[model samples]
Target: MPDDRVEVEEEPVSETRLSLTADCGSCFGLCCVALPFTASADFAINKEAGKPCRNLREDFGCGIHTQLRQKGFNGCTVYDCFGAGQHLSQGTFGGTDWRREPKSAQQMFEVFPVMRQLHELLWYLNEALTLAPAKPVHADLRELLARTEALTGGSAEELARLDVPGHRQQVNLLLLRTSELVRAQVPGKKRNRRGADLIGAKLRKAELRGADLRGAYLIAADLTGADLRDADLIGADLRDAQLAGADLTGAFFLTQPQVNAAKGDPSTRLPGRLTRPAHW
Candidate 1:
């Protein structure tokens, strides 16, 4: 899986703040091999899990990386491992490439998804700590972050048996609290659309400020020119959503993958942390 190929400044992440951005260079192309994808608008071919993508180079780089979208690999452009690939390749497996250590191939592949989930949790927790409104739960968030980070360092066998869903539930609580704290700062009535199926819904220029859009299916929704400031957009499905000129400034928990999937432009107001997709 190729990462969101957006050009931006790569900052040095602190020890406490894990790098949420995907670093494919330091990885062994685990996602390209471990994950399965069917032919669709996003992918051009069908590949089984644990099968290395034909486009994967011997050096673990994508053969057509620069032309991924052109070659019908749009899905690859939006997939982000949140730095899990490098961590698993170097940290968990001690820099042992699966191609060399054939015996550990299956374990490494199985552990990839688990580590990705843990890293995603760490990303959310780290962001929660930065919000001034979420200060009340900052300590609790840090504690959970430490615990989650510790889990990421677990051995392959330990990670394989981990209760990822249960762990996600625990992290979601703090993230929910953080969302409430942050959204409360916005004035007036806020919409509660959490987990709502608004696929392809026409929401052009809608007043969605401080809306609770967590886990909402907004796929291909027309959100052009909408006011989304301070919205809680965690886990929102934004694939092919029309976001041209929408205001997402200060939106909390809006990950890069979501932004990359949406159709945005120069006028789209994004939070500082995320970069504009190249194709947009």
Candidate 2:
């Protein structure tokens, strides 16, 4: 018989900064309105940009928050704006709601995506500074963080007109160097699967430690019990991947969206900033 011990519910170990995570209570339903989705394997229904989801409540909460997946809204769970929702709600917009100020709606919606990108970079740069092996690039990381943070705090017009891709390229260079320095410590042939299309491939229990899977398409792939320790997962597509018991310690740029999309067990060890999803 099982132990029958009452297991304490631990808050999922989150690897992201609090400011970078969605604060639904603080946000004003910007994500529900500003962004759009399409009917696909990822999203349940089609939604055009600049239009609010039909399920958005007057209080800016999802009507199906609890039954999102069961109600054919699984895609809602995978979408993450990297805390840009609250940042635009309370920070950039100064707590002024777009619904009340209809004129600001277009600008706020446009700038939200830009802010999301900026915050995402901030997350990466901030994580880069935490790696002891990446200490050599700490100064550069700080500079990049400062620049990205400034962009997040910019006015809607400034954010809408920002050269975000250019800035991201600069940050990516630093992240690439950081990946090299950190992966060197892990012994084995370092696998470079960057931007490779491996959709639905079977990779169960694979020796993937220190592998570079940046931008790789692992959609719905079986990665059960895989050893992803010290792997570079930056921009990797983990949507619907099976990560039950997979070790993702020190995985770079492994955001909540990717994690939420994947399946994992409570025993699965995560990086410092990653949060274990509840559906595991």
CA RMSD of each candidate after superposition: 5.6, 6.2
lDDT of each: 0.89, 0.81
Candidate 1, residues 130-164, lDDT tens digits: the string is: 77778789899989999999898799999999999
Q: Quote the lDDT for 224 in model 2.
A: 88
Q: Model 2: per-residue lDDT, tens digit, 1-280?
A: 2212111123233333348777888998888888898887656888998999989998999999998888788788888877888988998899998888989888988888898888888778767766667777878877777777877778888888899889889999999998887777677688888898989989999888889999999998999899988788999988889898887876766788889888889877787566787788
Model 1 TM-score is 0.94
Clashing pairs in 1: none
Return the top candidate by TM-score.
1
lDDT of 2: 0.81
lDDT of predicted model 1:
0.89
TM-score of each: 0.94, 0.91
Displacement of the residue 206 alpha carbon in candidate 2, Å: 0.8
